[model samples]
Target: MTEQHAFSSKVLQEDCLDYTPFLSSVTLARRRAARLVSEWGHPDIAGDVALVVSELAGNALLHGRVLGQLFRVQLILTAAAVRIEVGDACGERRPEVRNPAQDEKFGRGMVIVDALATRWGVVPRTVGKTVWAEIDLR
Candidate 1:
């Protein structure tokens, strides 16, 4: 009799998009995030993922932009969840969840991120910081 064996493998899926510090970058980032989420086999959570990406990328452009520097958006897909990260060149300005006034138009980005993300925080680097948010698809 011949013995038979089964083979299995695990692979990590990840991608990144770099953008200039232009205000229009936020729109591009959100669009790309939605498309990538769908392409990464998570169409079910594409809406939430895209919204989070918009907030994070908007925050980076509004608060973390530095002259002559660029920002990056990264996505990591795991078995149970997806992680999104936005890296910018301003380390001093950190993200915070603020309750804006009724008439306020801004200061709500972090609030939205906090409400949707399973977990989110900031990661400081040598020259800047990366704000990351994770969404559970399970």
Candidate 2:
């Protein structure tokens, strides 16, 4: 049997936005991701996309922020999948999935991201890094 890929190389639809590294930006990113996925005719995955966007964007704001720099969110839809990417201006920091204590209030963002996306990874950019997650449509 042939192995099925989670995402196609050909992009069918794409949307991108840049936001200031602020707390509100994470909410905006989540909303935008859900709307874009729904508009692209994949409402079933909208909630998952939104959740992943929230985690990635929140991580960028909290750990990857640089003064005067904005974090960017990009959504790319293919026939078989949707990919969400959050780019920030700090390459030195990398995202990690941590298992926090039961009473801990934070450190669960990457854990959520890891559980939701079919596949996720970081791509190093010239000045920073782009954290990306993909959800399969099939």
lDDT of 2 at 118: 86
Residue-wise lDDT of candidate 2 within 35-92, one digit each (tens)?
8899999899999999999999999999999999999999999877899889999999
Query: What is the C-alpha lDDT profile of model 1 across 49-103, one tens digit per residue?
Result: 8999999898888899888889999988877778888999999998888889999
Where does the lowest 10-residue lDDT sum fall in candidate 1? 1-10
Alpha-carbon deviation at 35 in model 1, angstroms:
0.9
| Clash counts for all predictions | 0, 0
Consecutive 10-residue window with the lowest summed lDDT within model 2: 1-10
- Give every collision pair in model 1: none
